[model samples]
Target: MGIIKKIFNKSRSPEDGIFFEEMRKILGFNPVDLSHYRKGFTHRSSNKTDENGNPINYERLEFLGDAMLGSVIAAHLFKEVPTGDEGYLTKMRSKIVSREHLNELGRDLNLIKWVESKVSAQHFGENIHGNLFEAFVGAIYLDRGFTYCEKFINKKVIVPYVDIPKLEGKVISYKSLVIEWCQKEKKQFHYDVFEDNGNEDVKHFGVRLKIDGKIVAKARATSKKKAEEKASQRAYFAFQEKINKK
Candidate 1:
Protein backbone atom coordinates (compact mmCIF):
# COMPACT_ATOMS: atom_id res chain seq x y z
CA MET A 1 0.00 0.00 0.00
CA GLY A 2 1.04 3.60 -0.53
CA ILE A 3 2.54 5.49 2.44
CA ILE A 4 -0.51 7.75 2.82
CA LYS A 5 -2.79 4.72 2.73
CA LYS A 6 -0.45 2.98 5.15
CA ILE A 7 -0.67 6.07 7.38
CA PHE A 8 -4.40 5.48 7.70
CA ASN A 9 -3.83 1.77 8.24
CA LYS A 10 -1.33 2.40 11.01
CA SER A 11 -2.94 5.30 12.89
CA ARG A 12 -6.24 4.93 14.78
CA SER A 13 -6.87 8.67 14.40
CA PRO A 14 -5.73 9.31 10.84
CA GLU A 15 -6.80 12.88 10.08
CA ASP A 16 -3.76 14.46 11.75
CA GLY A 17 -1.41 12.03 10.08
CA ILE A 18 -3.10 12.61 6.72
CA PHE A 19 -2.74 16.36 7.18
CA PHE A 20 0.94 15.90 8.04
CA GLU A 21 1.48 13.93 4.83
CA GLU A 22 -0.39 16.54 2.78
CA MET A 23 1.53 19.37 4.44
CA ARG A 24 4.81 17.57 3.82
CA LYS A 25 3.99 17.51 0.12
CA ILE A 26 3.38 21.28 0.01
CA LEU A 27 5.97 22.35 2.62
CA GLY A 28 8.65 19.76 1.68
CA PHE A 29 9.01 19.02 5.40
CA ASN A 30 6.88 17.30 8.01
CA PRO A 31 4.96 19.77 10.12
CA VAL A 32 5.82 19.61 13.85
CA ASP A 33 2.90 21.37 15.58
CA LEU A 34 -0.28 20.56 13.64
CA SER A 35 -2.50 22.98 15.60
CA HIS A 36 -0.82 26.00 14.00
CA TYR A 37 -1.64 24.64 10.57
CA ARG A 38 -5.18 23.76 11.61
CA LYS A 39 -5.67 27.36 12.72
CA GLY A 40 -4.31 28.53 9.37
CA PHE A 41 -7.26 26.92 7.61
CA THR A 42 -9.89 28.01 10.14
CA HIS A 43 -12.13 30.81 8.94
CA ARG A 44 -13.53 33.51 11.21
CA SER A 45 -17.00 32.23 10.43
CA SER A 46 -16.13 29.00 12.20
CA ASN A 47 -16.16 30.85 15.57
CA LYS A 48 -13.43 28.76 17.11
CA THR A 49 -11.49 29.90 20.18
CA ASP A 50 -8.53 29.01 22.37
CA GLU A 51 -8.60 28.00 26.05
CA ASN A 52 -8.37 31.67 27.04
CA GLY A 53 -11.13 32.53 24.52
CA ASN A 54 -8.83 34.24 22.03
CA PRO A 55 -10.61 33.81 18.70
CA ILE A 56 -9.14 31.08 16.54
CA ASN A 57 -8.95 32.05 12.89
CA TYR A 58 -6.46 32.73 10.14
CA GLU A 59 -6.54 36.57 10.23
CA ARG A 60 -3.60 36.98 12.63
CA LEU A 61 -1.60 34.39 10.77
CA GLU A 62 -2.49 36.09 7.47
CA PHE A 63 -1.14 39.40 8.80
CA LEU A 64 2.12 37.76 9.87
CA GLY A 65 2.35 36.00 6.52
CA ASP A 66 1.96 39.33 4.69
CA ALA A 67 4.87 40.78 6.65
CA MET A 68 6.91 37.62 6.04
CA LEU A 69 6.20 37.75 2.30
CA GLY A 70 7.16 41.43 2.18
CA SER A 71 10.38 40.84 4.13
CA VAL A 72 11.48 37.86 2.04
CA ILE A 73 10.52 39.40 -1.31
CA ALA A 74 12.24 42.66 -0.40
CA ALA A 75 15.42 40.80 0.56
CA HIS A 76 15.32 38.77 -2.67
CA LEU A 77 14.90 41.95 -4.75
CA PHE A 78 17.80 43.64 -2.87
CA LYS A 79 20.13 40.74 -3.63
CA GLU A 80 18.92 40.06 -7.18
CA VAL A 81 19.02 43.68 -8.39
CA PRO A 82 21.91 45.34 -6.62
CA THR A 83 21.68 48.33 -8.98
CA GLY A 84 17.95 48.96 -8.27
CA ASP A 85 16.99 52.02 -6.23
CA GLU A 86 14.62 51.92 -3.24
CA GLY A 87 11.64 52.83 -5.43
CA TYR A 88 12.55 50.17 -7.99
CA LEU A 89 13.09 47.48 -5.34
CA THR A 90 9.86 48.39 -3.50
CA LYS A 91 7.86 48.27 -6.73
CA MET A 92 9.39 44.90 -7.65
CA ARG A 93 8.59 43.47 -4.22
CA SER A 94 5.03 44.80 -4.49
CA LYS A 95 4.60 43.06 -7.83
CA ILE A 96 5.81 39.77 -6.37
CA VAL A 97 3.54 39.96 -3.28
CA SER A 98 0.56 41.63 -4.89
CA ARG A 99 -2.93 40.39 -3.95
CA GLU A 100 -3.39 39.03 -7.48
CA HIS A 101 -0.12 37.10 -7.31
CA LEU A 102 -0.82 35.70 -3.83
CA ASN A 103 -4.35 34.73 -4.89
CA GLU A 104 -2.87 32.90 -7.88
CA LEU A 105 -0.40 31.13 -5.59
CA GLY A 106 -3.21 29.95 -3.29
CA ARG A 107 -5.24 28.77 -6.28
CA ASP A 108 -2.24 26.89 -7.67
CA LEU A 109 -1.83 25.10 -4.35
CA ASN A 110 -5.61 24.41 -4.12
CA LEU A 111 -5.44 25.72 -0.55
CA ILE A 112 -9.22 26.09 -0.34
CA LYS A 113 -9.69 22.36 0.14
CA TRP A 114 -8.12 22.64 3.57
CA VAL A 115 -10.22 25.60 4.70
CA GLU A 116 -12.59 25.17 7.65
CA SER A 117 -15.38 27.66 7.11
CA LYS A 118 -19.05 27.85 8.00
CA VAL A 119 -19.66 29.66 4.77
CA SER A 120 -19.87 27.75 1.54
CA ALA A 121 -16.56 27.51 -0.28
CA GLN A 122 -18.10 28.57 -3.61
CA HIS A 123 -19.35 31.81 -2.08
CA PHE A 124 -15.94 32.80 -0.72
CA GLY A 125 -14.31 35.71 -2.50
CA GLU A 126 -11.00 35.70 -4.41
CA ASN A 127 -9.03 37.19 -1.50
CA ILE A 128 -9.71 34.08 0.58
CA HIS A 129 -7.13 32.16 -1.44
CA GLY A 130 -4.48 34.78 -0.79
CA ASN A 131 -5.48 34.98 2.88
CA LEU A 132 -5.10 31.23 3.24
CA PHE A 133 -1.67 31.38 1.64
CA GLU A 134 -0.57 34.09 4.05
CA ALA A 135 -2.00 32.17 7.00
CA PHE A 136 -0.14 29.05 5.85
CA VAL A 137 3.09 31.02 5.81
CA GLY A 138 2.31 32.32 9.30
CA ALA A 139 1.65 28.78 10.46
CA ILE A 140 5.03 27.74 9.09
CA TYR A 141 6.67 30.53 11.02
CA LEU A 142 4.96 29.55 14.24
CA ASP A 143 5.47 25.82 13.74
CA ARG A 144 9.14 26.04 12.79
CA GLY A 145 10.74 29.52 12.74
CA PHE A 146 12.17 32.23 10.49
CA THR A 147 14.70 29.83 8.91
CA TYR A 148 12.03 27.38 7.77
CA CYS A 149 9.75 30.25 6.76
CA GLU A 150 12.52 31.76 4.61
CA LYS A 151 13.35 28.36 3.16
CA PHE A 152 9.69 27.76 2.32
CA ILE A 153 9.43 31.14 0.62
CA ASN A 154 12.69 30.60 -1.27
CA LYS A 155 11.55 27.19 -2.40
CA LYS A 156 7.97 28.05 -3.41
CA VAL A 157 8.05 31.79 -4.20
CA ILE A 158 11.63 32.70 -5.15
CA VAL A 159 12.76 29.67 -7.17
CA PRO A 160 9.64 29.14 -9.30
CA TYR A 161 8.71 32.83 -9.62
CA VAL A 162 10.50 36.18 -8.89
CA ASP A 163 12.08 36.78 -12.30
CA ILE A 164 13.38 40.36 -11.97
CA PRO A 165 13.13 41.07 -15.70
CA LYS A 166 9.52 39.90 -15.95
CA LEU A 167 8.48 41.61 -12.70
CA GLU A 168 9.93 44.97 -13.81
CA GLY A 169 7.17 45.31 -16.43
CA LYS A 170 4.36 43.85 -14.29
CA VAL A 171 1.72 46.30 -13.07
CA ILE A 172 0.83 45.87 -9.39
CA SER A 173 -2.12 48.30 -9.47
CA TYR A 174 -3.93 49.39 -12.62
CA LYS A 175 -5.83 52.08 -10.68
CA SER A 176 -2.57 53.76 -9.67
CA LEU A 177 -1.33 53.55 -13.25
CA VAL A 178 -4.53 55.02 -14.63
CA ILE A 179 -4.51 57.93 -12.17
CA GLU A 180 -0.84 58.65 -12.80
CA TRP A 181 -1.35 58.62 -16.57
CA CYS A 182 -4.34 61.01 -16.37
CA GLN A 183 -2.50 63.45 -14.07
CA LYS A 184 0.66 63.44 -16.21
CA GLU A 185 -1.28 64.10 -19.43
CA LYS A 186 -3.49 66.80 -17.80
CA LYS A 187 -6.67 64.80 -18.55
CA GLN A 188 -9.72 65.07 -16.28
CA PHE A 189 -10.70 61.66 -14.91
CA HIS A 190 -13.36 60.47 -12.45
CA TYR A 191 -14.66 57.20 -11.07
CA ASP A 192 -18.44 57.25 -10.42
CA VAL A 193 -19.22 54.25 -8.22
CA PHE A 194 -22.67 53.05 -7.06
CA GLU A 195 -24.46 50.02 -5.68
CA ASP A 196 -25.35 47.64 -8.51
CA ASN A 197 -28.07 45.19 -7.68
CA GLY A 198 -27.99 41.73 -9.27
CA ASN A 199 -30.09 38.56 -9.02
CA GLU A 200 -27.09 36.81 -7.46
CA ASP A 201 -26.93 36.46 -3.67
CA VAL A 202 -23.79 38.56 -3.31
CA LYS A 203 -24.11 42.35 -3.44
CA HIS A 204 -22.02 44.08 -6.08
CA PHE A 205 -20.77 47.58 -6.84
CA GLY A 206 -20.46 49.20 -10.24
CA VAL A 207 -17.95 51.82 -11.36
CA ARG A 208 -17.93 54.04 -14.45
CA LEU A 209 -14.60 55.47 -15.56
CA LYS A 210 -14.90 58.86 -17.21
CA ILE A 211 -11.96 60.54 -18.87
CA ASP A 212 -11.87 63.92 -20.59
CA GLY A 213 -15.67 64.32 -20.34
CA LYS A 214 -16.30 60.87 -21.91
CA ILE A 215 -17.33 57.60 -20.28
CA VAL A 216 -14.38 55.35 -21.05
CA ALA A 217 -15.11 52.13 -19.16
CA LYS A 218 -17.58 50.43 -16.81
CA ALA A 219 -17.14 47.38 -14.53
CA ARG A 220 -19.12 45.61 -11.77
CA ALA A 221 -17.62 43.53 -8.97
CA THR A 222 -18.35 42.33 -5.43
CA SER A 223 -16.61 45.35 -3.88
CA LYS A 224 -16.06 48.99 -4.80
CA LYS A 225 -12.30 48.46 -4.82
CA LYS A 226 -12.58 45.57 -7.26
CA ALA A 227 -15.10 47.39 -9.43
CA GLU A 228 -12.92 50.48 -9.57
CA GLU A 229 -9.81 48.45 -10.27
CA LYS A 230 -11.57 46.54 -13.07
CA ALA A 231 -12.73 49.80 -14.66
CA SER A 232 -9.22 51.21 -14.27
CA GLN A 233 -7.75 48.09 -15.89
CA ARG A 234 -10.10 48.51 -18.85
CA ALA A 235 -9.28 52.21 -19.07
CA TYR A 236 -5.56 51.40 -18.96
CA PHE A 237 -5.89 49.14 -22.01
CA ALA A 238 -8.12 51.68 -23.78
CA PHE A 239 -5.47 54.37 -23.33
CA GLN A 240 -2.55 51.91 -23.54
CA GLU A 241 -0.96 53.56 -26.56
CA LYS A 242 -1.20 57.02 -25.01
CA ILE A 243 -0.26 55.86 -21.49
CA ASN A 244 2.86 53.98 -22.67
CA LYS A 245 4.17 57.05 -24.50
CA LYS A 246 4.83 58.92 -21.21
Candidate 2:
Protein backbone atom coordinates (compact mmCIF):
# COMPACT_ATOMS: atom_id res chain seq x y z
CA MET A 1 0.00 0.00 0.00
CA GLY A 2 2.83 2.40 0.84
CA ILE A 3 4.60 1.66 -2.44
CA ILE A 4 1.37 2.09 -4.38
CA LYS A 5 0.69 5.45 -2.69
CA LYS A 6 4.21 6.60 -3.47
CA ILE A 7 3.82 5.58 -7.12
CA PHE A 8 0.47 7.42 -7.32
CA ASN A 9 2.07 10.57 -5.92
CA LYS A 10 4.95 10.24 -8.39
CA SER A 11 2.46 10.16 -11.26
CA ARG A 12 1.18 13.66 -10.31
CA SER A 13 2.72 16.64 -12.14
CA PRO A 14 5.70 18.31 -10.45
CA GLU A 15 4.21 21.77 -10.81
CA ASP A 16 0.97 20.58 -9.18
CA GLY A 17 2.91 19.00 -6.34
CA ILE A 18 4.78 22.24 -5.69
CA PHE A 19 1.58 24.26 -5.84
CA PHE A 20 -0.11 21.88 -3.40
CA GLU A 21 2.77 22.15 -0.97
CA GLU A 22 2.83 25.93 -1.14
CA MET A 23 -0.94 26.06 -0.69
CA ARG A 24 -0.67 23.74 2.30
CA LYS A 25 1.90 26.06 3.87
CA ILE A 26 -0.33 29.10 3.30
CA LEU A 27 -3.72 27.53 4.10
CA GLY A 28 -2.49 25.30 6.96
CA PHE A 29 -4.11 22.27 5.30
CA ASN A 30 -4.12 20.33 2.03
CA PRO A 31 -6.65 21.51 -0.52
CA VAL A 32 -9.27 19.05 -1.75
CA ASP A 33 -10.02 20.86 -5.01
CA LEU A 34 -6.87 22.32 -6.50
CA SER A 35 -8.86 23.42 -9.57
CA HIS A 36 -10.84 25.86 -7.45
CA TYR A 37 -7.65 27.46 -6.22
CA ARG A 38 -6.28 27.65 -9.75
CA LYS A 39 -9.44 29.39 -10.81
CA GLY A 40 -9.08 31.75 -7.89
CA PHE A 41 -5.67 32.84 -9.10
CA THR A 42 -6.71 33.05 -12.77
CA HIS A 43 -7.15 36.53 -14.25
CA ARG A 44 -10.05 37.22 -16.58
CA SER A 45 -7.59 38.39 -19.21
CA SER A 46 -6.54 34.78 -19.58
CA ASN A 47 -9.96 34.24 -21.16
CA LYS A 48 -10.36 30.72 -19.87
CA THR A 49 -13.61 28.83 -20.08
CA ASP A 50 -14.99 25.61 -18.70
CA GLU A 51 -16.25 22.76 -20.95
CA ASN A 52 -19.75 24.19 -20.73
CA GLY A 53 -18.52 27.53 -22.10
CA ASN A 54 -18.80 29.38 -18.80
CA PRO A 55 -16.02 31.83 -17.95
CA ILE A 56 -13.35 30.61 -15.54
CA ASN A 57 -11.70 33.32 -13.50
CA TYR A 58 -11.38 34.86 -10.05
CA GLU A 59 -14.10 37.47 -10.37
CA ARG A 60 -16.95 35.14 -9.39
CA LEU A 61 -14.89 33.67 -6.60
CA GLU A 62 -13.96 37.17 -5.41
CA PHE A 63 -17.65 38.00 -5.10
CA LEU A 64 -18.27 34.87 -3.04
CA GLY A 65 -15.25 35.55 -0.84
CA ASP A 66 -16.42 39.09 -0.19
CA ALA A 67 -19.73 37.77 1.11
CA MET A 68 -18.01 35.11 3.23
CA LEU A 69 -15.63 37.65 4.75
CA GLY A 70 -18.51 39.96 5.58
CA SER A 71 -20.51 37.12 7.17
CA VAL A 72 -17.65 35.91 9.37
CA ILE A 73 -16.64 39.42 10.39
CA ALA A 74 -20.19 40.40 11.14
CA ALA A 75 -20.72 37.33 13.33
CA HIS A 76 -17.49 37.90 15.19
CA LEU A 77 -18.27 41.57 15.75
CA PHE A 78 -21.79 40.75 16.96
CA LYS A 79 -20.47 38.32 19.58
CA GLU A 80 -17.44 40.38 20.69
CA VAL A 81 -19.16 43.76 20.83
CA PRO A 82 -22.43 42.90 22.46
CA THR A 83 -22.90 46.51 23.51
CA GLY A 84 -22.49 47.79 19.97
CA ASP A 85 -25.66 48.67 18.13
CA GLU A 86 -26.34 47.42 14.59
CA GLY A 87 -24.87 50.56 13.04
CA TYR A 88 -21.73 50.34 15.15
CA LEU A 89 -21.22 46.65 14.41
CA THR A 90 -21.73 47.16 10.69
CA LYS A 91 -19.21 50.01 10.61
CA MET A 92 -16.66 47.94 12.51
CA ARG A 93 -17.09 45.04 10.13
CA SER A 94 -16.61 47.40 7.19
CA LYS A 95 -13.34 48.62 8.67
CA ILE A 96 -12.14 45.04 9.08
CA VAL A 97 -12.94 44.14 5.46
CA SER A 98 -12.01 47.45 3.90
CA ARG A 99 -10.10 47.29 0.58
CA GLU A 100 -6.96 48.71 2.21
CA HIS A 101 -6.97 46.05 4.92
CA LEU A 102 -7.69 43.28 2.41
CA ASN A 103 -4.88 44.48 0.13
CA GLU A 104 -2.49 44.46 3.05
CA LEU A 105 -3.46 40.90 3.95
CA GLY A 106 -3.01 39.70 0.35
CA ARG A 107 0.38 41.37 -0.02
CA ASP A 108 1.56 39.89 3.27
CA LEU A 109 0.60 36.43 2.05
CA ASN A 110 2.35 37.07 -1.31
CA LEU A 111 -0.64 35.71 -3.17
CA ILE A 112 0.19 37.68 -6.30
CA LYS A 113 3.18 35.43 -6.99
CA TRP A 114 0.79 32.58 -7.81
CA VAL A 115 -1.58 34.51 -10.06
CA GLU A 116 -2.02 33.29 -13.67
CA SER A 117 -2.44 36.32 -15.91
CA LYS A 118 -1.97 37.18 -19.56
CA VAL A 119 -0.83 40.67 -18.58
CA SER A 120 2.33 41.31 -16.59
CA ALA A 121 1.80 41.25 -12.85
CA GLN A 122 3.53 44.62 -12.50
CA HIS A 123 0.89 46.16 -14.76
CA PHE A 124 -1.88 45.10 -12.41
CA GLY A 125 -3.17 47.74 -9.99
CA GLU A 126 -3.10 47.66 -6.21
CA ASN A 127 -6.66 46.35 -5.95
CA ILE A 128 -5.58 43.12 -7.66
CA HIS A 129 -4.07 41.96 -4.36
CA GLY A 130 -7.33 42.37 -2.51
CA ASN A 131 -9.33 40.78 -5.34
CA LEU A 132 -7.10 37.71 -5.35
CA PHE A 133 -7.27 37.46 -1.57
CA GLU A 134 -11.06 37.39 -1.72
CA ALA A 135 -11.03 34.82 -4.51
CA PHE A 136 -8.69 32.62 -2.47
CA VAL A 137 -11.06 32.87 0.46
CA GLY A 138 -13.90 31.86 -1.81
CA ALA A 139 -11.92 28.90 -3.09
CA ILE A 140 -11.21 27.80 0.48
CA TYR A 141 -14.89 28.06 1.37
CA LEU A 142 -15.83 26.06 -1.70
CA ASP A 143 -13.17 23.38 -1.22
CA ARG A 144 -13.44 22.93 2.56
CA GLY A 145 -16.79 24.44 3.59
CA PHE A 146 -17.82 27.22 5.95
CA THR A 147 -16.06 25.91 9.08
CA TYR A 148 -12.66 25.93 7.37
CA CYS A 149 -13.42 29.29 5.78
CA GLU A 150 -14.18 30.79 9.19
CA LYS A 151 -11.01 29.29 10.65
CA PHE A 152 -8.88 30.63 7.80
CA ILE A 153 -10.26 34.16 8.15
CA ASN A 154 -9.90 34.09 11.96
CA LYS A 155 -6.31 32.95 11.74
CA LYS A 156 -5.30 35.38 8.99
CA VAL A 157 -7.47 38.42 9.80
CA ILE A 158 -9.21 38.49 13.18
CA VAL A 159 -6.54 36.91 15.39
CA PRO A 160 -3.78 39.08 13.98
CA TYR A 161 -5.43 42.44 13.26
CA VAL A 162 -9.01 42.73 14.52
CA ASP A 163 -8.30 44.48 17.78
CA ILE A 164 -11.50 46.18 18.86
CA PRO A 165 -9.77 49.20 20.39
CA LYS A 166 -7.42 49.67 17.43
CA LEU A 167 -10.19 49.15 14.93
CA GLU A 168 -12.40 51.66 16.74
CA GLY A 169 -9.79 54.36 16.14
CA LYS A 170 -9.02 53.29 12.54
CA VAL A 171 -10.20 55.60 9.79
CA ILE A 172 -11.74 53.44 7.04
CA SER A 173 -12.83 56.37 4.86
CA TYR A 174 -11.20 59.82 4.98
CA LYS A 175 -13.85 61.07 2.56
CA SER A 176 -16.63 60.32 5.02
CA LEU A 177 -14.71 62.02 7.80
CA VAL A 178 -14.20 65.18 5.75
CA ILE A 179 -17.82 65.26 4.66
CA GLU A 180 -19.06 64.86 8.22
CA TRP A 181 -16.77 67.60 9.46
CA CYS A 182 -17.93 69.94 6.73
CA GLN A 183 -21.58 69.29 7.53
CA LYS A 184 -20.99 69.83 11.24
CA GLU A 185 -19.16 73.10 10.63
CA LYS A 186 -21.94 74.31 8.31
CA LYS A 187 -19.32 74.91 5.60
CA GLN A 188 -20.18 74.38 1.95
CA PHE A 189 -17.97 71.68 0.42
CA HIS A 190 -17.80 70.03 -2.99
CA TYR A 191 -15.58 67.65 -4.94
CA ASP A 192 -15.08 68.92 -8.50
CA VAL A 193 -14.03 65.83 -10.47
CA PHE A 194 -13.08 65.82 -14.15
CA GLU A 195 -11.29 63.58 -16.61
CA ASP A 196 -7.54 64.15 -16.57
CA ASN A 197 -5.93 64.24 -20.04
CA GLY A 198 -2.84 62.39 -18.95
CA ASN A 199 -0.60 60.42 -21.30
CA GLU A 200 -1.24 57.06 -19.69
CA ASP A 201 -2.81 53.76 -20.76
CA VAL A 202 -5.37 54.07 -17.99
CA LYS A 203 -7.75 56.99 -17.65
CA HIS A 204 -7.28 59.25 -14.67
CA PHE A 205 -9.65 61.53 -12.84
CA GLY A 206 -8.61 64.81 -11.27
CA VAL A 207 -10.37 66.12 -8.20
CA ARG A 208 -10.27 69.50 -6.51
CA LEU A 209 -11.91 69.59 -3.10
CA LYS A 210 -13.50 72.96 -2.45
CA ILE A 211 -14.40 74.06 1.06
CA ASP A 212 -16.26 77.39 1.28
CA GLY A 213 -15.48 78.10 -2.41
CA LYS A 214 -11.75 77.74 -1.74
CA ILE A 215 -9.77 74.91 -3.36
CA VAL A 216 -8.34 73.19 -0.31
CA ALA A 217 -6.91 70.09 -2.02
CA LYS A 218 -6.28 68.69 -5.47
CA ALA A 219 -5.48 65.10 -6.37
CA ARG A 220 -5.67 62.59 -9.23
CA ALA A 221 -6.36 58.85 -9.44
CA THR A 222 -7.65 56.11 -11.76
CA SER A 223 -11.21 56.74 -10.65
CA LYS A 224 -13.27 59.76 -9.66
CA LYS A 225 -14.17 58.18 -6.31
CA LYS A 226 -10.51 57.59 -5.53
CA ALA A 227 -9.53 61.05 -6.71
CA GLU A 228 -12.16 62.61 -4.46
CA GLU A 229 -11.04 60.46 -1.53
CA LYS A 230 -7.40 61.36 -2.12
CA ALA A 231 -8.25 65.04 -2.24
CA SER A 232 -10.40 64.68 0.86
CA GLN A 233 -7.56 62.93 2.72
CA ARG A 234 -5.18 65.74 1.86
CA ALA A 235 -7.79 68.31 2.89
CA TYR A 236 -8.25 66.49 6.19
CA PHE A 237 -4.52 66.74 6.92
CA ALA A 238 -4.42 70.37 5.81
CA PHE A 239 -7.28 71.20 8.16
CA GLN A 240 -6.49 68.54 10.76
CA GLU A 241 -6.26 70.86 13.71
CA LYS A 242 -9.48 72.68 12.84
CA ILE A 243 -11.39 69.53 11.92
CA ASN A 244 -10.24 67.48 14.92
CA LYS A 245 -11.36 70.22 17.28
CA LYS A 246 -14.89 69.55 16.02
TM-score of predicted structure 2: 0.65
Model 1's alpha-carbon lDDT is 0.85
For residues 100-159, write the lDDT of model 2, one tens digit per residue: 999978876779988898999888999998999999999999988898899999998897
Instruction: List candidate 1 stretches off by more than 4 Å.
Output: 1-12, 170-246
Best TM-score goes to which candidate? 2
Q: For model 2, which pairs clash? A: none
Tell me, by lDDT, which candidate is best: 2
Tens-place lDDT per residue, model 1, 1-246, is: 353454445543478777887888889876777789999999999999899999999999999999988888888788888899999988888888989989977876778888998999978999998999999999999988888899999998887556565576677778898899889999999999999876534567999999998999999876798789878877877777666888
TM-score for each candidate, following the candidate numbering? 0.64, 0.65
